[model samples]
Target: MSTLLIKNARNIVTMDGERNVYPGGSLYAEGQRIVAIGYDLPYDKADAVIDAGGKIVYPGMINTHHHLYQNLTRNIPFAQQCGLFDWLLTLYEVWRQLRPEDVYVSAAVGIGELLKSGCTTTSDHFYCFPNGVSGELIDEEIRAAQELGIRFYPTRGSMSLGRSGGGLPPDEVCQDERTILTDTRRVIERYHDADRFSMLRIGVAPCSPFSVTTDLLRESAALARSYGVRMHTHLAETEDEERFCIGRFGLRPLDYMEKHGWIGDDVWFAHGIWFDDGEIARLGHHRCGIAHCPTSNMKLSSGTMPLAKMLKAGVRVGLGVDGSASNDDSNMLLETKIAHLVHRLTDGPTAPGAEDFLKIATVGSARVLGWEDAIGSLEPGKAADLFIIDASKLEFAGALFDDAALPVLTGLSQTVDTTIVGGRIVVMDGALVGVDERKLAESAQAAADRLLGEATFRTKIDYRARRNALSM
Candidate 1:
């Protein structure tokens, strides 16, 4: 049995129940799980001992939502200034050109960015499937996560209704529901690990209300439960979607979701921005989770999510970067920072503080992704997933003088120095291990260039129309 020791020189913010902060603390791990954490632990006998001098260690940030494949199409000029529907319409053509290699490269870039931002575990929603792209898309993402040594949740997302069939995505980008379901099961059978320190998991997500039929959502959720996995989808994102659901389903998004069995502790929806008080109450009652994408919501001009209200109502909420294309940046720390600031702006003086935001980014997100008991804290028997930030950075210089809690320090700006997942170091000194960042960036750009040139893919898109004749 191999063992690793993490000794320190500064502070260790164990985001456990007591939320203890140990000065000059140490953590010990055997295999992939943490064995002990406290001050001045015996660390002489170990395979590896990392001395984190003058830094702050905290639970690694957890990203509950993302579209890793979107990294291949980040900053597309045509979609730079559009709303959700229009943006998807504009990018559908480009996303149609996705190949296995494109997914591979973007997963590298996206996961690398998340690691640098102190996220050790991330869930990626990859729904676009054109030119016969299969679950191999997600396989590539999992492969990248494996090489980087970060915990991964690869949601096998699908769009069953195309523009031709009254959906937002183009015909080429959507897939048959049967094929999607069968492939989802296949991926789960092949990749979903249920072990305590599993490096990978699989979730089933039927893209969104506007892109999938009610049957797909119900069946996907049922299938996920059958395999004991989780469910995820995009819901109540924008006012436009609200109106569309009202007109099409005779109810709002959350009500329609309820009609389709999409509410539960095992299910989470991204961008719960437009839900009403009733809907929020219902989610809390059912224990549904929400993946809060503050930056992406603000970037798309979607309305503010009632985060404080949701929290007050006992909803499970977590922070997410959303998608690389929408966020244009995969930074979980910045997402937490923005979440903290925006919640205060929306909630006035009664708002959540920096500690709340940190919890959402770490433990809260882990719970949203159904990983709470295994990750999200530096507790003994949990996975050794944590990150250390150099508190001496220029952005955080003054805050260290009076900061008592590391979560409080989250409001202060900082960059992560080390990120470890499952007792493995994936990022050290703020750089990705075993990979070339410059080469990854260049390769992503090159793939984006080639994807933009697919004429067949371009012909499949309808930039403004909500539906096309081929929608199922």
Candidate 2:
């Protein structure tokens, strides 16, 4: 029965179907639903009021893919310059040292960063489950997301095939197929709410094509569908992965996955950077989704995703920050900037514009996660999840001419003035509510130090030396 009102002075980027922008706008919310949004409102009545004078409000960015736990393992010197395969090999050695607390703390820190970047909803793909830690890793991530008050779509990611089984991850990090399935079901029953505005939802992800077996993929997708949940996985990310799929499965990545019940609207793949023209058509036909990670793709030299072609081909596309280790940061606004600039460089005039990038992070990403009706844009009866950027800031001075284009063209890499999720203020006045920022940072650093020291895998491989040796 509580009401909150955002009074006006600036612009409101509605991002609705009509692409409306209201000047000197105001919005009112009752509990979790947006009751009204227009140029003016009864500014005198509300339980709480935020004077959004000289600000530009837009739908909060939704992150469709992330490895929140990887926040604890970023900036690793040994793995800094490596590509996908070598990078995973080096990091698996360190990720095996993960404890339950590491998942909790890392997810908290990662979520903190995403909120500051104007992200209100996110799906974390946490597949690394070392021995004795598999039981409660998803629980920890859900707990962190709940505490932070952001809409969470955490995929119950699993890897059932290890190096012993000719997969990429080490033995300790992979789980039995039965265990992964059972845990996925348990989490769905426990945390996955099917209500329209529910905050937490679960998905089934069996890591990547190279890190899991064919049987695991089929079973995970089936389990997810049986529970009325969604399916997620990494597919066709790099050339190396494409080769792996071809050699082992004797088909392209998309073909192999499609045969295993993964080619449908309810399923989405992360780092979808290596599909052919025919495969893109298939994706469009099946209505599958792609979580495009522009920053991670460039960082790993994974090749361009042909985003404009995919969009034109009628395939659903969304934006994700990928893993913290690959992206090195979880900022949706920053991701939007990179996605906008890189696509223009690769796709030319038909590339996505600044407003298009904003839609990708909001409307398109919500479509990928199947939460479009509830979360995406600013409309009546939709969840009140959005962020306000103070247009008066120095960086946004001259860029206010186009409010929709400004966020993507002139990105804000810092914390926003306000971020609201489901009619709740998770962040206000550039600080997180109900969390001790400094203390949590110190805890994350201490935990990272411990994890680095406790890693049994030696960081003995000198990447720079290896490169020099290769040249010789």
Candidate 3:
């Protein structure tokens, strides 16, 4: 078994039960699990050691929701100012032309950015599958995550209700219910690992209420439960979604989901911005999880999530960057910073502080994925997942007084120095350890050019011109 040690950190902010902070701390790990964390750990000999002097270490942040494939289409000019529905309408045309290579490159780009920004574990919600495209697209995503060595939870997301069926995506991009469930089962059997400190886990997710039928939701939940995997989907993200649910099912989003057997601890819904008091209470009671995407919400002009109320109601809340197309970036620390600022503006004194949001991003996110027992915090027997930031940097020079809040408050505009996942260093000195970033960016740009070029040719819409018009 390989051993790793991180010693002499300026502060180790372990997001443990007691929220321990060790000054000049050291941590030792055997294989994937942490063996000890505190001052001056004994028996320091190891295959690898990170001397974290002048740096602050914290439990690795977890992103509960994302669409990594959307990295190819970020900041599209026409789609920039649109709300969720119109935004989907605009991007679906481009996304429908996605190839397998596109998925792989985009996942690499997104995962690399997340790693550089101090996220060790992330869950991606990839739902778009064009009609003519063959091969397992989610498999490509898994390969990318493996190459980069980031802990990944990839949901087998499907969209069955097409525009013909009053859904948002075109009919070509949607699949039949049978195919969706069969693939969901196949991925779970093939890729899911429920063992402690697992590198990959699979989830069952039907895109959303408007994009899927009731039958698909119920069956997907059943399939996931059968395999003992978690389920995820987008819900209550916008007023349009709330209206869609009420118009179609005569119930709010939560009630509709609950009626379909989706109300449980194992199920997590993304962008839960539109739920009411009753829905929040029910969510807390049933222990449903919410992946709050503050940047996406603000970018789309979606209302701020009632974060303080949800926390007071005991709901499970975690931070996510959502999709790169919407949020336009995959930096989890930036997401954490935005989560802190937005809630403070809306929830005022009742809003949780920067430290609380850090906990939410770590422990709360692990709970959302039902992996709390293994990967959330830094403690003996838990997964060795954490990141180190140099507090001596100029941005953080005077902010060393509050080590816990440094990442959210002052560590803005900078990536962490080192990011370790499961006793492995995937990012060091603000760069990916395993991947060539320049070549990856070139390939990503090529893929994006092909997709947008083909989409414009087919649809006769000048997507680039529209974006260019913005600058002019």
Candidate 4:
């Protein structure tokens, strides 16, 4: 077993129950969990050591929701300047041209962006599936996450109701209910891991209230519960979605979901920006979670989420970058900063402090993903999943007093110095380990260009061949 010692950190901000910070700290890890963390803990033999004398350490930020495949279609001009529905409608045609290689490469690009931004774990909601695409799309994403050494929870996201069936997505991109659930079972049986500290888990997510039938949502939730996994979906992100739910189901978005047995602690929804005080109270009462996507909300001109009221009501609130197509990037740190600033502009400057936003990104997000027991905090027996930023860096000048609040307050919009996940170093010295960032960037840009028709796809990728290449 290998061991690593993170010695002499300038500050280790543990997002624990007390929100403790250790000055001149050291953390030791063996295998996949933290062994000790404090000032000058006993440690002799170690496989590697990180000298973090001037660096601030934090529990790796966890992202509660994302759509990784959208990385390939980020910032399309037509889709860029629109509201949620118009944006999705314009992009769905482009997304319908997806290939297996598109999923693989785009997942890598998105997860790599997350790693660079100090996010150790992220949950992605991938729901788009065009006709003729291989059914093993989620498997490709899982393979990408494994290769990149990021903790991933990929939901078996599906869309069954198309425009022909009174849904928002085109018919070609939606699957039948039987096909969706059967693939959900196959992926869960093949990839889902329920063990604590496990790197991969499966979540079942229908696209949204506007895109999937009521029966599919109920069945998907039941199937997820039977497998003892989590459930996720897009919900209440926009007024348009709310109106759609009201017109079709004769209920508000949350009411529609509640009717489908899609409430409680087992489920979390993305872009919960439109919920009112009563709905937030109801969600808090049930311990249902909301993944607040601040950047996407602002970008799409969707109304700001009632962050202050939700927190006051004890709602389980977390942070998400949403998707690259909407947010245009996977920088969780930027998302955190915006989450803080937007609320202050809407609620007050004193609404959510830097520490509160930090917890929401770390512990709060872990809770939403049902991984709180293992990976959220920098404590002994928890996974050694965290990132280190050199506080002495010029960007952090005169901002060292409050390390916990530094990221959100001052806005660290660049890569951290190092990142470790599951006791392994995935990024070092502000660069990714075991990955060629330049080549990945080149390859992904090529794939993105092809997917969006900017660059012709001269090379057709075979999923089996891509899997074989990954095995090497």
Candidate 5:
């Protein structure tokens, strides 16, 4: 078996059951499992060794929600100032032009950015499927994640409610229920791995409340449960969504979902910001998980989630970068920083600290994805997924006092020195191990340009002119 060792870290924030911090620590791994973690681990030789002296080591952050395909739609000028509904309306036209190549390149770009920012495991919610394009878009995403060597949980997201049915997306991008479920089963049988230290898993996600019918929601959950896989979707993200649910279903988002048999520990929702106190309590009671996207919420003008209330209610909460279209980038460390600051601003001194958000990013996220037993902490028997940050850097000079909070408080724009997933080094010296970043960026730009051009020509909409008009 191959062996790897990380020696002499300035401090190792283990995020273990006791939240241990080992000063001047070392960790050893045999294959994908951590063999030992403590001060001065024994045995000298290994296939590879990372001298982590002067670096702070932490379990790699887990991103619980993302639309990796949205990387291609980032920074669209017309959608920048719009709130959630208007933003979706503006971007749907562009997203409908997505080709299989767009999905591959965008997933690569987004996952590569997450790795640089120290995220090892990421869950992507890719739901947009244009009618004429290849149905193997999720396959393309899996290919990209595999090439990048990051652990992936890709949900086969679908949308079956169209504008004619009072949903947001156009009919051209929506699929029939049979088609959605058929592909969901195919992906699960082909990709969902329940074993420990699995590199890829599949989940079922039927877009969001406003874009999917109630029948699709119920069927998707049933299919996921039958295969013993997890379920994910966007829910209670905005006031607009709340209104849509209330107007259509005669119930709040949570109540509507609960009626559909979606309230359970095996299900997690992205951007859960619009729930009431009772709804929060019900979610906690059901042990349902929530993926908090602080930056994306702020960018879309979605109100602050009752984070303190949810934690107090014993809800399972985790951090996610959300989609690149709304977040405009995939950087987990940056997301942690924003989560810390936003909570402090909204929740006052009683807010959870930076270290708390770090745990939420690692342990809480692992729990949300139902992989807690395998990959959240730096302990013996857990997967060897972690990252190293050079605490000796100039930006971190005065912040080493709190090693656990160092990344969340001061890692602004700080890429990690090394990122390892499944005992393999996917990033070293703040760069992807085997990928040419320049070429990837150029390809993404060209693909995005092509998509936008085709979309504009088909719709006869001048996005630039719209942006100019709005600004004036």
Candidate 6:
């Protein structure tokens, strides 16, 4: 029954059906849904009125993929310059020391950073657990998101195949297939909310092709369908993965997934960078989505994804910040900015505009996350989830040109000032509202120190033994 109104916004980019851009716009929300969207509103009767005189408003950015717990292990110096497989190998040892409290604290820090950068809805791919850590790791993260007031989707992610059974991770970091399946069922029973405007939803993810066995993937998909949840995993990320699948399974990554019943509308993959035309067509046929991580791909020297080609082929393309250890940050605005530039380079310049990138960050990502029906656009009948950017911030000053600002949110001027989730203002005037961020940071650093101090964590796993002459 709480009523809020936003009036006199300098600009409003509504990525609704018409894709309207209203200058000096006004909007109102009642309960958790948007009730009105137009210009010059009567704000006198609202319980609260946000006077957005010098700000721009848009649908809140959606993060399609992330490993919020990986914030603790970012920039571990030994892992910085490695390729895809090497990078995971180097970090798995360090990640084995993570605790429940570590997961909680790191999720707080990662989600807080994302909120500051305008991401209001974020999906986490937390697949690593070790040393008797309980499935309550996900519960702890959900509590953290509630404290920060961000819409969260925490997937029950697992890895069932260890090095002893032909997987990438060592035996210590892998879980028994039965235990993983049972815990996934328990979590879904406890937390999978299916209602609109739900603050939390659950997904089922079984790490990736290399870390999980084929039976696990097939079973996970079947279980996800039974529970009506989404499926996510890493696929065709690098040339190494392509070669590994072909050498072991005698099939390309996409074909292997097809054989295992892993391709469909309910599934999405991270980094579809190495997909051939046939594989791309397979994605379109199954209506699968892709979470494009431009910065992580570039940093790891994985080839650029064919985003322009995917869009042309009607593939569902969205943006992801990927894992913190890979991209080292959860800044969604920067991720979209980099994606914009990278797409232009892939198309040989004179390509898409900033507005196109904004769409990917907002609606495109929501579509991938299966939240477009509730939270992706600034339109009546949708959840009133959006963020405001202060045009006066230093990075954005002198960036808004002319009386009519373009539909695009440019890389130079996307500085977030306030973020509202489901009609609740979680951040205002560049400061978080509820939690003491300084306190959260201190706790997170302490947890990171403890994880990094473990004897096994201190040793980096070298994949030199697996490196063949043709690996390069």
> What TM-score would every model get versus the actual structure?
0.94, 0.96, 0.98, 0.95, 0.98, 0.94
Q: Which ten residues in a row have the lowest lDDT in candidate 4?
A: 463-472
Instruction: Select the stronger candidate by TM-score from 2 and 4.
Output: 2
Ranking by TM-score: 5, 3, 2, 4, 6, 1
> Which should have the higher lDDT, number 3 or number 4?
3
Best by lDDT: 5
- lDDT tens per residue, model 1, 1-472: 6787888748888778887878888889998889988876866678877887777788899999999988877776556677888777777777877889988999998899899888999998988888576556788888998888889998999999888888888888888888899889989999999886788899999999999988888889889999999999999999999998998889999989888888888899999998889899999998899999998998888878999889888899999998988999898888887887887888888887777678788889988988888999888899888888777777676578533344344544445788888878888888888888898889988888787766334465433334433222
RMSD of each: 3.7, 2.0, 1.9, 6.1, 1.4, 3.2
lDDT of 1 at 117: 84
Local accuracy by lDDT, each model: 0.84, 0.88, 0.90, 0.87, 0.91, 0.83
lDDT of 6: 0.83
TM-score between candidate 5 and the true structure: 0.98
Clashes of 2: 0
What is candidate 6's TM-score against the reference?
A: 0.94
Better of 4 and 6 by lDDT: 4
- Tell me which residue pairs clash in candidate 2: none
Model 1 steric clash pairs? 163-468, 164-468, 164-469, 164-470, 164-471, 165-471
Cα error, residue 93 of model 4, in Å, equals 0.7
Residues forming the 10-long window of minimal summed lDDT in candidate 6: 463-472
lDDT of 6 by residue, 84-124 (tens): 88778777877888788888899999999888888899999
Name every residue pair that clashes in candidate 5. Answer: none
1-472 per-residue lDDT for model 4 (tens digits): 8899999988999999998899998999998889999976889568988888988899999999999999988766555557788777767777888889989999999999999899999999989898998988988899999999999999989999999989989998999999999999999999888889889999999989989999999999899999998889988888999899999989999999998899998989887888888999998998888899999998989988888788888788889998998899999888898888888888786687878999999999988887899988999999999999988778888877888998877745568889999889999988999899999989988887767662223223321111222111
Q: So what's the TM-score on candidate 3?
A: 0.98
